[model samples]
Target: MKLRELALISSGINERRNPQGTIYYIGASDFVAPSLLNKLIKPSIMPSEKLEKHFLTKQDVIVLGKGHNGFVGHTIVDDSKPMVASSSFMVLRDFHVKVLPKYIAWYINLESTQQELRSYSRGTALPSINRTILGDLEIKIPPLKIQKQIIEIDELKKQESKLTTQLDQLKTIQLELLLKNKIKNYEQ
Candidate 1:
C-alpha cells in the first residue's frame, strides 16, 4: 500500500505557539548529531493550548520549522519528557499500525524522497512545506519485519563507525611513538 494510505498528520499548515511561559529555541547547530534524530530543543514553558495540542513524543517525526529549506524529517526517539518545537517544524505522528516510524523517517531522508519534497516546497523568499501536501505525498510501504531489520542494520553500521574511529586513534598514536623512536636513534 502507499505511504499516504497508512500515515496521518496535520491536514495543512497548523501554525501555533507554545503557552506563554519561556520559549526555548533549537538552532541550526543542534542538527549535527550522527543519530537518525539529531536536534531537539526543550521548551521550559509553552502555551497550555499548544502544549495540549502539539506535544512531542518518541517515534514522532518532526520537520524543520523555519529557515532551512529542505530539512523535513527526523524521528524523535530519545526524550520522553514534554518539549515544544518551533512553529517552523511540523510533527508527523505515526499512527500506522503496520509501519515503523524509524523506517518511514529513513525513507524520507533518502535522496529520492528529498527530490520529491523539493518539488513540493512553497513560499517565494523562504521555502517551506505545506502540511497538507506532505500528508498527501506518496510513499511505498514495506512489511513491518523488513522495517525493523533495516533499523537493526543501521544500528550495526553505527557500532562499526565507533570502532573504526577508535582504531584510527590507536594507529595515530602508534605512528607518533615510532617517529619519536626514530628521532632518538638519529640523536644517538
Candidate 2:
C-alpha cells in the first residue's frame, strides 16, 4: 500500500513524564533499540508544555529534526513504556491496520526516502522538514506477514553486528599480546 493512503496521521507528544518524572533527551549516540529502545542517556528534562503532544509509543514512527536533517530518517518504538521526544523530532501516527509500523519506519530510512527528505528540506543556513512535508512523503509496504519477516531479518542483523564487534575486540587483544611477547623476546 502507498504510505499516503495508509494511516496518514501525525504523532502526539506525551503530556506527562515517566513515574520518575524525567524527560529523556535523545542524543546522536542514544541506543535506539531495535524493535525496543533498551537504553538512552537522560541528558535533561523537558516541561510538560514543551512536550505536550509529542509522546510516541510501541508502534509510532519517529523522525529526526534539526541538525541531522534527513540523516537518521525514521524508527518505530517497540518499547512498551511511553517516552517523550525533543523538539528536534517528529512522529507519524498510524491511521490504518493495513500498514505495519516497523515496516513503515524502515521504509522511511531507505535510500529513496532519504532522497525525498533531502529534497523536502528548505532553508538557506539549516535544512529542516515541516510536519506537512513529512506527512506528504510516500512509501511502499508489503502484507503483515512479510513485514514480520523483514523485522526478523533486521533483528538478526543487529545480533550479527554485536557478535562481530565482540569478535573483533577479542582478536585485537590477541594481536596485542602477541606483539608484546615478540618485543619482550627481542629485548632478551
- The C-alpha TM-scores of every prediction are 0.70, 0.75
For 34-58, candidate 2 gives per-residue lDDT tens digits of 3344464552554566464555555
lDDT for position 45 in model 2: 50
| RMSD in order of candidates | 4.4, 3.9
lDDT of 2 at 91: 62
Candidate 1: misplaced stretches above 4 Å?
1-4, 11-28, 34-49, 65-69, 123-126, 169-188
As a whole number from 0 to 100, the lDDT of residue 105 in candidate 2 is 73
Best-fitting candidate, scored by lDDT: 1
Each model's lDDT comes to: 0.65, 0.63
Query: Which sections of candidate 2 miss by over 4 Å?
Result: 1-4, 8-21, 27-29, 32-40, 46-53, 68-82
